[model samples]
Structures are given as structure tokens and as C-alpha cells.
Target chain A: MKGSANRRVLPGYGLSLGYTIFYLCVIVLIPLAGIFIKTAGMGWADFWHTIWNARVIAAYKVSFLTALAAAGINAVFGLLVAWVLVRYKFPGKSFIDSLVDLPFALPTAVAGVSLTALYAQNGWIGSKLEPLGIKVAYTPLGITIALVFIGLPFVVRTVQPVLQDLEKDTEEAAVMLGAYRFRTFRKIVLPEIAPALLTGFALAFARGIGEYGSVVFISGNMPMKTEIAPLLIMTKLEQYEYAGATAIALVMLVISFIALLIINLLQARMNKRTISA
Target chain B: MAGAVTAHLSEEASVRPQHINESVLVRIVLITIALAFLTLVVIFPLLTVFIEGLKKGWDVYTASLRDADALSALKLTLIVSLIAVPLNTFFGIMAAWAITKFKFRGRNVLITLIDLPFAVSPVISGLIFVLMFGAQGFYGPWLDDHNIQIIFALPGIVLATVFVTFPFVARELIPLMESQGVQEEEAAVVLGAKGLKLFWLVTLPNIKWGLLYGIILCNARAMGEFGAVSVVSGHIRGETNTLPLHIEILYNEYQFSASFAVSSLLVLLAVLTLAVKKFVEWRGSKWQSK
Candidate 1:
């Protein structure tokens, strides 16, 4: 098959193709498949029991909901940041734009420790917000905050180039045709960029769901309260409950895979609609 | 008018006069939220260490930087990164080359697989290695019989890092390579260059800056890797500890200034990367135009 398509593309079809497949097999498929096999030994009853326990169920809720909330936050603010960077030329714009990737490049442990310090009692803004009866540290909110932190750059970076290349004339025409600002945005601008935005959201959501390093310090790890799924998995591993840990991880993997698949399908549908319209 | 909008673009346009009052209100609200979010998420906590470090004087701050564990951790970081980064760079470049320069069986699947590390959490990355290489893992007994140590050691840290940071260089390289056409490389081939000579004389020149940019980003992430390292590494103080782990140890033991001092060093590296990115972008514009 590649040999046939080789006429259309580059030479050396065999070498690069072989290398790509071999590399993927080694790096990704082997380990992930190993995980599936590892969990296969639990049998149906144990698998269900392991994933549905009181602690596990509670962790599922906190982890999933906080990740959703964080992804939602990133989707909105990320779009705003990307829009600002693309449409405006303010002082320090470049600095802020570059600053977006700080989370991406920064070590997660450092981020975890730093976030804890900043939001803990007696810390700078934590102290200020504490009087308002809002606890930002060692709470579910802190988990969401860290999620938003690491997830922001995904949305920004994913959406920015699309925003940049989006034609201004289309928006101008919408405004001239008696569309209100919000209407112009709703009908014209949003449709064009919605796919990228959704991609950003999905990426962040998947990422937030699996996150550990940034949330560990901030979560307070109180069982039935702030304990996240990944942390719970780590806790299980720490306790030498390897099967139970992998079982929980298998639950996350299956659910995340299904959810992300739906998102990708939605993204593809959106892209198709955009192309047709 | 379109002209007016273009002129406004030059002027860093504020909300137009029609939206002025409302947007000023909106702007204030937005800025407050953005600044507050930044404060809570990034600025304040990061600033705390610096302020706390300086609370004592410059002399103590200087003294803190010279601590043996701190220096050794830094040395280990440089050592591991110095080897690990270049090796990963080679992997990333070859991987990227395989990705972009060919279309083969399961190409889309391969692309998705390459992206697996990014989607998988750092914690999982660590655990996978522990599952693969630890004493209880598959290869564990064999490795032990061979008198080879992998886990809870430097090799484990590097392997975990290579796995975690594997995608970065490839991720950066692929997009740039895709956007960049094969015309130049074809031109080099047309000029009778082959193999390494072709890559060196033709392709490498075009993608050199791109490859460099990816390597630098990869290096930064590899240098600061923590979550995965924390898992596999037993944190043997001076032995398996990297800088970030070292900082965590210091902070845990209440060595505030020393911890801050070491963390500040990591921050400096990050700042340097950010600065280099600026320079790289400045240099890239002309090439991008090609």
C-alpha cells in the first residue's frame, strides 16, 4: 500500500514506514496493552467491585467534575487570552504570550509545591481570599486551580494560530449586516474557531483527569473529599495493592478513552459542518 | 471602517467609544480576575521563595546556593540532562523524520501513539516504568541476576524522563517540518547530495533552527521533570536526587533559604529558555517567509 502511494510522496517509503511502526509498537502499544493484560486477571466481579467501592466512587466524582470545571474554565479564559494575543498589540503582550507555556515547561512537582505555597493559609493571595471565606488551598477548588494552570496553555496554544488565521472580513461583514456584537460573534466568529476551541477543551479535560503532580500538594488528600483518582492510584501503589491500583487505572483509561473518542467525533463533525457551511 | 480598524491595530486599540464605559467596567473586572488568577496560580507562591530567601541578607542567600546537596543535585540534573537530552533529541529527530517524511501502514495510528505520552499523566509514566523495570516488574529478576540496577536509581530517572519528554522534541519538530516544504531538500538532492551529505547539505540547513528550538524546549522539560522522577526514584538524597526533588527535600526539611535558592536556579533556567525562544522566533520570521 505504501509502495503504491510512494509515487505520490517522498522516496524511501519502506525505511521510514518500518521505523514508525516499530517505534510505536515499542513505545506505546506494548506498555498500554500490558496494562490491559495486567487488569484482565481481576475477573469481572473483582473489577466491578474494585472500581465501584465507596472511596473509588467518591474519587471518581471529584476527579471527573473538577477536571470538567477546570477544562471549562480554560476553554473560556484560554480563548480570551488567545484572542487578546492575536487581535491586540498591547505592551508586554509577547511576555504574557510566552508566559503561557510556563506551566507546560515547569516541573509538575515545582508547580505543586508552588501552588500550595501561594494558596496555603498565610500565603499572599490565600490570606487575602481567606477572609472572604473562600479556601483556595488544600481543597477541591485548589485541585481545579492547578488543573486550570496546566490546562491553560493547551487551550491557548491550540486556539491561537486558528484565531490568528481567521479572516477579519467575515467578522466585519457580520457586524455590518446588523448583527449585534454578541450575534456577530455567535454566528460568524465562533463557528469558525469552535473546532479548535473544542480540541483545546478536550485536550485539557483529558489532561486534567489524569493529572497528579500539580494537584498532589494542593488536594490535602483527605479521603472522600479531595482525593483524586490518580492520587488514589498512587496511594494504592504505595500500599502495595498493585492489582487494585491497576484496576482503578483501568477504569479511568476505559472511561477517558470513551469520552475522548466522543469528543474527537464531535470535533470532526464540527469541522465538517464548518466546511459545508 | 476596515482602515480605521487597521489603524487601531497599530495603536493598541481600547474598547471603542460606543463600548467605552461598559468595557472599562468590563476591563477592570477582567483585569482583576486575570491578575488575581495569576497571583494565586503563579506569581505569589513563586515570589514567596524569593522574598523569603532575601529576608536574610545577600550573604546568606549566596551561602545557600553553595550547599553541597544543592550543588550535587544541580550537577546530577546537568549530567542526566546532558546525556538524556541529546539522546532524546536524536530519537525525536528520527521519530519526526519517520513521521513527516513518509506515509506507511498505520500512519495515523502511529501519530496517535506518539501522542500517547502527552495524554498519559506523568504519574502514570512513572508507574509504567516501575511496573516495567522495578524489582517486582517483568524484567526485574533478569536485570537483578545480571547485577544491573535500574529502578530507584539514575537509570530509572533517565528512562522515565526519556519517556515523559519523548514527545516534546518530536511534537515541536513535526509541525514545523510539515509547514516547511520539501522543495529545499529536493533541491539538495537535485544537486546530487545523498544520505548524510543530503541531510547536512540540504535538509539540515533548513530544519536546523527548528531542531534547535525543539531540543531547547525538550531540555527545559527534561531538566525540570519531577512527578515521574519522584515515583521511580527512591530519593536517595545525594545519589538519585535531581534538582526539583532536591528542592522538595530541602523544603520538607524546612531548609527554606536553601530550597528557595535552588528553586530560583530552576526558575532562572526557565527564564533563559523563554528568552531564547524570543530570540529564536526573531530569527525564525525570515525563514518562515520561505
Candidate 2:
């Protein structure tokens, strides 16, 4: 394969390719395979029973619903934030724009602690909210808040570039042709950026589902109430229920992959439609 | 005639199309809503970290930093990142080189496989390691006989960090190198540049900024990683605890000031990461325009 007569133009092709495959096998593939192999050892009835318990079912509901709500909230507000950053020039605009990535850079535990501090019953914002009878920390609402915090940047970052690429003249022309501001945005601008928005939503939802470090602090971690799927998996592992943990992880992984695949397909379709139109 | 013409011109001015911006009142409302959301979600939590860290006093904050456990946790984080970042950097460069420089079968499939870790939960990233090396794991008995520990130790932490951060560099480099094309490398090869010399002279300098950006993000995540590390670390005070884990210990014990102090160190790193990231983006855009 390395003979000079049949050699490719790029040098080190064999060496680099071999190292990549070998490294990937050790680093990624083999370990993931371990999950399947371990789960295979369990009886189908046991696996189903482990994953389908009432407490686990409630956890799945909380995880999916909170993640969905958070991602939906982000999809709407993230667009507004991205649009504001791109289109409007204001005092401290650059500062706020850079601040959007704070959640990405901050350690999740730190985020968890700080958010828990801020929204706890006697804490600053929490004290005020307590009077209004709106509890944030240690509730399902608190879990959603933490999810929203971590998921914000996904939507904003994904949509910002697309929004920037949208030609200003198109929006202007729509308005000039008697379209109202709302109509112009809905008909002209939204369709152009909808795919990016959907991609962002999927990314955020996937992230929220798997989120552990941040939510554990704010969620209060009561099994039937605030316990998330990842934390439940952690609990099972702590009890050395390896098979049970793997069963739950398998379900989460499959769901996330399927959701992401559907989103990718939708995005591809949207891109095709836009290009043709 | 002049008065009539002026009146018509005034009418045209009144009927002129609105700019992309909404009415001033509406724009104010939109901007305010957006800014308020950011302030609530991002800025407030950041401020809380510092304020709570200093809530006790300067001396208490200093005491937390000087605590033996905090110092050791910091050292372990540094060690873990030092190992993980360089190893991943090398892997990323190799993977990117293979994918970008060659036309191959199953290329897209390989790329997707490389990205599998990104889609995985951090908890699962750690769980897989436990499955691979835990007492009941595949090699667990063999390892137990040899007295070699991977789980509940530094090696486990490093492996988990590497798994979570596997794609950062390659993801950054693939698109960049793809856009850069292979003309330069092909030219170098034709001119008799071979092997390491070719990469050293031609490729490294070309992808330097992207590589640096990738390394910066990788290092930050490696140091700050919590969920995966937490699962495998066993939280042995100063033994396996990274900074984030240490913060969790302190916070759980209700040592609020101490936890915040340890957290302040990570906050500094986060700030530094963002600053360098911004610089890299600026430089990258400038280079592209050239």
C-alpha cells in the first residue's frame, strides 16, 4: 500500500488513517459497545421492568416535558436575542453578545450551585418570588429554569449566522409590497431561518435530557417529583445496579439519536425546498 | 407652484417605508425583553458566584483557596487536563487529516461515528467506562488480579473527559481544512516535502488558529467537566476530586463561601476561555478576508 508507484499525493495517508481508526476504536467505539453487551446479559423481562417502573416512568415524563418546555422557550426567545444582537446596536451590546456563551464556559456544578443559591426559598430572587407564590428552586419549574439556562446558547448560536445571512432587501421588499411587519417576519424571514431554529431546538432538547450536574442541585432530587433520568441512572450506578443503569442509558441514547436523526432529515428537506424556491 | 411641490415632497417623506427595525416604541420593547432574559439567565448567576464567594469576607475566601483539599483538587484538575488535552489534540489532528485529505468510502459514516460521543450524555460517558472496567466489567477481574485501578481513580476521570471532548478539535478542523483545500499540501509534496516535514512546513501553520481555538475549548471543558468526572471520581476528599467535584463537596456540606471560592477559580478560567475564543474568532475572520 505504501509503494511509491501507487502512492497517493498526500503523504502520511496510511499512517494518519490507521491511527485515527485505531484511536477511535479504543476511545469511542469499544466502550459504547460495552453498553450493548452488558444490557444483552439481562433478561428481556428484567430490562423492561427496570426501565418501566412507576418512578422511572415519572422521571421520563419530567425529563421530556421540562426539556421540551425549555427548548420551546429557547426557540422563541433565542431568536429574539439573536435578532437583537445582529440587528440592533445598543450600549453594552457587545458585552451582552459575549455573555451568551457564559453557560458553555462555566462549569455545570458552579452553574448549579449559583442558580440554586439565587432561586432557593430564602435567596434573593426566590424571596421575592415566594411572595408571589411562584417557587423556582427544588421544583419542576426549577429544573426547567436550569435547562433553559444551559440551552439558551444553542438556539442563539445556531440561528445568529443564518439571521445574519438573510438579505435585508428581502424583508424591505416584503414591507414595501404592503406586508405588515408581522406578516413580513412570518412569511419571509421565519421560513428562511426555521431550519436553524429547529436544529437549535433539537440540540437543546438533547442537552436538557442528558443534563445532570446543574439540575441535580436545583431539582431537590426527590424521586417521584424532581429526579431526572440522568440522576436516576447515577443513583442506580451508586447502588451498583450496572445492568439497570445500562438499561436506562440505552433508552435515553436511542431516543436522543432518533430525535436528532428526524431533525436532520427535516433540516435537509427544508434546505432543499429553500434552494429550489 | 413651489409651495405645491414642497407639500407633495413632505407627503412622500411621511409615506416612506419603515426600516427593518420596528417602530421606536416596539424596538425598545423587543430589545428590553431580550436583554432582560439574558440578565436573568446569564448575568445574574455569574454575579451570584462572585458575591457569594465574597459574602463572608476576604479572609474566608483566601482560607478556602489555601485549604488542602482545594489545593489538591486544583492540582488534579491541572494534571487531568494536561494529559487529556494533548492526547485529544493529537487524535483530532490525525482524524481531521485522514478525513479531509482523502476521498474514501464510508466517509460520512466515519464522521458520524466520531461524533457519537457528542450526542451521548456525560453521565453515560462515565457509565460506559464503569461498564468497561468496573468490578463486574469485562476486564474487571483481570485488572483486579493485577491490582490496576481505572475506575474511582485519575485514569477514569481522564478517559471520561477525553470521551466528552473527543470531537471539539476535529469538528473545528474538518470544516476548516475542507475549505482550505489540498492544493498547498499537493504542491508541497510535488516539491519533495515528505512526511513530518510536509506537515510541519505546510499544514500546521495553515491550521494553527483553528487548532488553538480547539485546544482552548478542550482545555476549558476538560478542567470544568463535572457530571462524568463526578460519576467515576468516587469523591475521595482530595484524592480523586477535581475542582468541580470539590465545589460540589463544599456546597453539599453547606460550606457556601468555600465552594464559591473554589468556583471563582473556574470562573476565571471561563472568562479567560471566552476572551481567547473571541480573539481567535476575530483573527480567524480577519485571516479569511485576506
Candidate 3:
């Protein structure tokens, strides 16, 4: 069985592999390379200036901070949601479970408009909050709301399978050993599902950072305040500053890739640990 | 006598400790919080879409859908998805087949590269294409010399869509096909089956559900794509606007009813996608268990 390492039994390997590489290059690789190439064409100083400009810096702060905030919120709430779905059998459970994927399915623009409508000053949720002098729409808080909505499914879906697979006996055994319920959950259950939760947090954070459509309408696009990095890139492009846009995009791309790589490594380690434990 | 009574009680409790789960009060609290969160984040916006669409009455809602620009936007969205979905499906199948069926180095790297689109911002997804094909881009001179346009046109829209949705199908199939392995296909080959015959008669049936699952997700994303398409579409009314872009345009113009009306169509599509996805998952699980 080990001797056939260099040979394959299947036909069309050449053709299929060729087509795959070619299509990937055309549709994905070549265009991504274009970003680096274009950014490289700009002088180092110019590139740095474009990316580190005060306005761009503000946008970065707003984007990263809100994304982090939103991902943090989703981690706690999404865990509770997944836990409830897995542990409890309640009426409308299936309906609630189905709705978790709504963000994935709904068009972001639709989400943006509807959320904005619902949270605007005179709108359903906003009017109630406005009387308390707490603005939601047209603020950073609004951007976080949109990101949380879009990022909810990532956390829930990632954690759901892991929760379902968690053995009940370990929990029961923990109780039998004189461990309290909270201790059992913290020591036994949390360790098993921690990796999935981290992965979901990373995904949601990555998505929230790059999110455009849903945040755009709600954020009000104020230059120094509510503007997101993606919207800034869009603004640069609309301004016909291609080099500037590419520079900002390249920065975001590199950051997201690094974040994903770290998350992947962490998840692999967690899996190995769980297997050994 | 008291010790004897205590021992008996302890034995009974040890024999059947109540299930290691939340108390009824705790369960009720958790469920309430989860449902409240879902209602706020998911259900309310959905309700708003329909409510606002009908705010001006049924006639206005119907009229908006029949608007000429709305009709054109719908057509453009359909056309883009129609083109983007098939191309991606073909690529997905080919890529998955190659990776799963062959033993090769750098395979992991290739898979990572395939997922590049997912990690990239949608705005950047559009920007990359513009950098490659925009007026000041590398191919700009060549395209202009040949009197062809891509940026700010239909082709650009389709390419951006393809980029955003590039990973959906391949990502779905790779894990599935990897699990299925090539033993069955090898057996088929030993029986003299080859090429399209092998794929159609053997592999297709085996992975049909997974493939369908991939296509459903890919189609949904293709139709719902907004940020990337918006960048390249030039916002040319009735020409470059897809349904999402159209919604943005109408919303910006304060045509609330019309925006929500067109949005209702997309909402319907989203619901349909969810329903089909549920059905597919159910069917896929049934097959897998078999």
C-alpha cells in the first residue's frame, strides 16, 4: 500500500490539475498578485504615507476596535446560543437554529438597510433608545451591531458541531467525583470546545474587519469616526486613487492572512491536545 | 437509628443523581436570552424589510417590483449568477478531483491559495481586479488598444463575483471527497471505466449531494454578492446595477418603499436558499448514515 506513493490510479489527473491551476490563477491568484504589484510600483514613502495617513489610521482604529468588540460579544453570546441549541430541547428551537444562518444567506445590503431602518432615530428600536440619549444608528455602536449580525453564524456554526459531539459521560463523571457543575463545565466542557470557539472568534473578527455592505449604511460614513477601512478603500477607489487603495488593501490582506494562519495553528494544537487528553 | 436513615437516603441519591444539566430556572433564562438576541439581530430586520415594503400599501410594493430599473437589476443579478455559478462549479469540481485523487507536494499551499478570496476583503476583491484591469492598471493599455472594456462593465462584475465565490464549492467538496477516497474510483478503473464515464457513473452519484450542497451555497453568494460588485459596477443606473446595488441606490434616493420592495425579492431568495440548504443537509446526512 505504501509503494504506490508516486503513482495514481485515476485518469484525467493532468487535465484536471492543469485546469484547476489555470482557473485558480485567472480567477484568484493573478488578481491578488496585482495588488502586490501595484502597491510595489508606489515609492515606499508614498505607500507608507497613504496607509499611515491620519484619516486612514482613524479608519483602521475604528475597524479593528469594532471588529474586536463585535467578535468578543459574539464569542460569549454565540457560545450560549450553541449551548442552548445543543443541550436543551425547547419549542421553536429548530426555528431559532435556522435563523442563525440568516446572515450568511441574506444580502448584506439588505441587512444594512433593514438594520438601519430598524435602529434609526424614529425607527422601532432607535426611537426607544433615543429618548434615553443613547444613539445606536450612525455611530460606531451601529457598526458593531451590523458586524455582530453578520458574524453571528460563524461562531454558532463553528461551535455547534463541537458541542453536539461532547460526551455527556465526562460531565457526569466529573459530578460523580465531587466536582460542582460550574467546575465540570469549566474544566471538562470548556477545554473540549475552546478550539472551536477560538476559530469562530477569528473568523468573525476577520469578517467584521472586512465587512463593507452591512456597515456602510449604518455607520453613516463619517470620515474620522464611523468610516471603516473597507469603506475607505472604496472611497479611495472612487477618488481614482488606485495606488492608494491598493496600499490600504494590501495592508488589510496581510493582516487577515496572518490572523488566519495563527488561528489555524492554534486550532491544530488544541486538537492535538484534546486527542492526547 | 438516625445514621441508618441517613445511609439509606444517601444510597438512593447516589443511585440516581439528577441529570448533570441546568436547572429549570437556568434553562428558562438561557433560552429567553438566546431567543431575545436572535429576535433582535435576525428576526427584527427581516420583519422590517417586509413591513416597510408594504408601508405604502400593496399597490406601491407591486409597482416597485414592476419598475423598469428594478426589472433590469433583477435580470442583471440573474445573468451574473447564471454565469458565475457554473464557472465556479466547474472549477470546484476540477480542483477537488485533482487535489483529492493525486498525491502531491505543496497541496496544502494550493488549498490555502484557493481560500485567498475568502480572507480578502470584498472591497479589495474588487480593487484587485481594478488594479489588473482598470484604466491605470497593467492591462489597461492592452485593453484600450484592443478597444475592450472590463472595469465598470458586466465582465468586471462577473469576475469580482467569481473571485468572492471562488472558494465555496471547492471548500465544500474537498473534505467530502477526501473522506470518500479513491478506492471506489480505483475499483471502477480496474473494471475498465475511464474519464467522463467513470465520473458520471461512479463519482457523480457518490458525491452528488455534497456537490448540490456546494452549488446551493455558491449560488446564494453569487446572487447576494454586493461589496465587490458595487466597486466595479460604476453605479450605472439600469445598466450595471444588480439587485443589491439597486437596493442601495433606491435607499440612498429615499425611495424607501421601492428599495424594500426589491429587497423583498432578495429576502425571498434568501429564505429559499435556507430551506433548500436544510433539505440538502438532511438528505446528505441520510446518505452518509447509509
Candidate 4:
């Protein structure tokens, strides 16, 4: 058996591998290369100034912080929701499960408007919230609300399968050994789900950073204030500030790329450790 | 005597720990909270917008579709997606077939690369094209030499779309193809079937649902796509504006009803896609269970 040839039935390599590289080049690589080449022409001093200007800097703070906040919120509650959907037996559980993806399929523009209408000062929930001294519609809070709306699916979807696949017997065994709920979760469950949670967080954060459609309708697009990075890039393009726009985009590209790479690596490592265990 | 009582209490506790047995009151409260979250987040905005549009009577809502700007914007969106999705589907199929049906080095890498668009925000995808084709971009001079109109036009819109949607079809098809091994193909081969006949007969039937699912998802995203399209499109009113762009224009011009009216239409389309997706997934699972 060991000596026998056991080649898989699918096609062999070489040609398809070459084609894959070529296809990726035409679609992804060349385009990124072109962006860099355009940016390369800009003097570093100007690039620094354009990207660091008050407006751009504000956009950065709004986009990065809101995205982080949104991802954090999603991580906590999204996990709870996933846990409920996976571990519970209840009526409408299936419906709640399907609803996780509703955010993914909903158009962001519609999502933005919908959120604004609900959270605007005069809007339904906003009218109620206003008397409590919490403003949402045109503030950074609005930005976070929009980010959270779009980012919800990432964490839920990422963590759900891991939760579902987690065997009940492990928890049972820990309980029999006299471990507390918190201890069992911390030692047995949290480690299993942590990497996936991190991946979801990174993805949600990346999406939050690049969100434009939802934020625009709600943010009021206030310059040096409520504007997000994506909106700023669009502004630069509209204003004929190509260098300005691409420069901002380059910074985003580097940060998001590095963040995504780390998350993906962590997910792989976690998966490997799980397999080995 | 106290030790005996304590031992009895410990024995009973060991038999069953006291738990928050989720009173009927608690369950209702929790359910209400969930419902409120859904209604506020997903349901209310959509219902309100559509209701407002129709509040002025269907006559006004009906006439919005006839607006020159709205019509042209729709026409552009339809045309661009019509071209972009099919082109992408072909690439998606080719990529999926080549990748999933093959065993090779870098296969995992290709799979990840294919999904790059999913994680890369559509806004970035749109900007990448602009960086490739904008007036001051790297390829702009070479492209401008040919007097080509790419960015800020229909071509630019299509290119941006093609990049953003590149993953959907391929992603949809992979799991379907993977779960379906080459058993049928091997059978076909043993029967001396080859080439197009083999693909059309043995392969197509097994994976048609996935292909359709991917195509529909791709189309829905393309049709409503705003962030990426906004970046690449100049939003030159009726010229480059797609349906989403048109809605923004209407909203900005203070034609609130018309914007929501158009958005109502996009929502309907999304719902249609969602239905089809459910149907396809349902169909696939049935086959699996069988």
C-alpha cells in the first residue's frame, strides 16, 4: 500500500498554476502596482503633508476608532448571539440564525439611511434618545452605529461554526471534574474560539475603516470632523486631488493589509493547534 | 446535627445545581429585545422609506421610474452589470474549475487570493481601479494616449465592479464543487466521455445550483454597489450614475420620496436574491441529505 501510486483524480499542476498567477497579476497585482507607481511620483514631503493635514488626520481618527469600537462591540455581543444560536433550543432560532446574514445582503446605502432614520434627532429611536442627552445621528456615535451595523455579520459568521463544532462532551467532562462554568469556558472554550474571534474582529475593523455608503448618509460628511477615510478619498478624487486621495489610500492599504495578514496568520495557527491537539 | 444538615444540603446541590431556570418573564423579555433589535436595525428603515414613498400615492411613486435621470441611471447600471457579471462568472467558472478540480501546489494560495475581494472593502476595490485608470494614475498616460475613456465613465464602473465581484461566483462554486468529488467525472471518463460533453453532462448538473447562486449574489451586489462605484463613477448625473448613485442624487436634490422610491426597488431586488439564495441552499442541502 505504501509503495502504490495514489495520485488524486484532479488535474495535475504546471499549466493551471501558471494561469492562476497570470490571472491574479492581470486582476490584482497590476492594479496595485499602478497605484504605487502613481504615488511614487509624489514628493514624500507633500505626501506627508497631504495625509497629515487636519482634515485627513480627523478622518483617520474617525475611521480607525469607530471601526475599532464597532469591531469590539460586535466581538462581545456577536459571540453571545452565535453562542445562543448554536447552543440553544428555542422557537424562531432558525429565523434568528438567518438574520445574521441579513446585514451582509442589505445594501449599505439603504442600511445607512435606515440607521439615520431610526437614530436621527427627530427619528423614532433618536427622538427618545435625545432627552437622555445621547446624540447619535451626526456625531462620531453615528459613525460607530453604522460600523456596528455592517460589522455584525463578520463575527457571528466566523464564530458560529466553531461553536457548533465544539463538542458538548468536553464541557461535560470539565463539569464532572468540578470545574466552574467560567473556568470551563476560559480554559476550554475561549482558547478554541479566540483566533476566529480575532479574525472576525480584524475583518470587521477593516470593513469599518473602508465603509463609505452607510457612513456618508449618517455622518453629515462634516469636514475635519465626521468624515471617514473612504469618504475623504472620494472627496480627494472629486476635488481633483489625485495625489492626496491615493496617498491617504496608500496608508490605509498598508495598515489594513498588515492587519489582515496578522489575523489570517493567527487563524491558521489556531487551526493548526486545534488539529494537533 | 448541623453537619448532618450541611451534608444533606451538599448532597442535594450535587444532585442538581440551582440554575436560573429562565422564567417565562425572562424569556419574553429576551425575545422582545431580540425582536426590537431586528425591527430597529433591519425592518423599520426599509418599511418607513417605502411607506413614505407610497404615502404620496402610487402615482408619484410610479412616475419616479419615468424620470429621465432615474431611467438613465438604471439603464447604465443594468448595462454595466450585464457585462460585468457574466464576464466575472466566466472567469469565476474558469478559476473555480481549474482550482477546485485540481490538486497542485499553491492551490491554497489561489483560494485565499480569490477571496481577497471579500475582505478588501469595496471602497478600496473601486479606488484600485481609479489608481489604475484615473487621469493622474500610472496607466492613465498610456490609456489617455489612446483617447480611451475608462475612469469616470461606464468602463471605469464596469472595471471597478469586475474587481469587487470577482470573488462571489468563485466562492459560491468552490464548496459545491468540493463536496461533489470527481466521482461522476471518473465515471464519465471510464465511459469514454471527454471534453465539452463531459463538462456539460457530468459536471454541469451537479453544480448548476451553486453557479446560479453565485451569479445571483454577484448580480445583486453589482446592482446595488455604491461605495466602490461612487469612487470610480464621477456621478455626472445621468451619465455615470448607477441606480445607487441616482438615489444619492435624488436625496441631495431634496427629492426625498424619489430616492427612497428607487431604494425600495433595490430592496426588492435584494429580497429576490435572498429568496433565490435560500432556495438554492435548501435545494443543495436536500441533495446532501439524500
Lowest lDDT block of 10, candidate 4 chain A: A1-10
- Which of the CAPRI classes, incorrect, acceptable, medium or high, describes model 1? acceptable
Which portions of model 4 miss their true places by more than 4 Å?
A: A1-20, A178-187, B1-32, B141-145
TM-score of 4: 0.89
The digit string of per-residue lDDT tens for model 4 on B2-85 reads 000000001111122233123456545655665566566566766867876686788899899788989998899899889989
Clash counts per candidate, in order, are 0, 0, 0, 0
Query: Residues A1-277, candidate 3, lDDT per residue (tens digit)?
Result: 2224544788988998899999998888888999888888899999999999899999999999999999999999999998888777787766677788889889999999999999999899999999899999999999999999989988888877777766668888898899987888899989889988898888899889999999999999999999999999999988998889999999999989987797668667867876786
Q: What TM-score would every model get versus the actual structure? A: 0.89, 0.94, 0.95, 0.89
lDDT of 1 by residue, B1-290 (tens): 00000000122233333421124455455555655555555666567667766767888788878877777888888888887788667766777767666554666566666766776667677777777778877788999999988889888888788777776677767766766656666656557766667666666777777677678878888899887788888888778899988878887787767777777787777777766666667667765456
Quality of model 4 by C-alpha lDDT:
0.76
lDDT per residue, candidate 1, A148-175, as tens digits?
9878877877777666666656766766
Chain B only: TM-score of model 1: 0.86
State which candidate, 1 or 4, has the greater lDDT.
4
lDDT of model 2 at residue B100? Answer: 86
Instruction: Rank candidates by DockQ, best first.
Output: 3, 2, 1, 4
CA lDDT of each prediction against the hidden true structure: 0.73, 0.86, 0.87, 0.76
Name the regions of candidate 2 deviating beyond 4 angstroms: A1-7, A270-277, B1-18
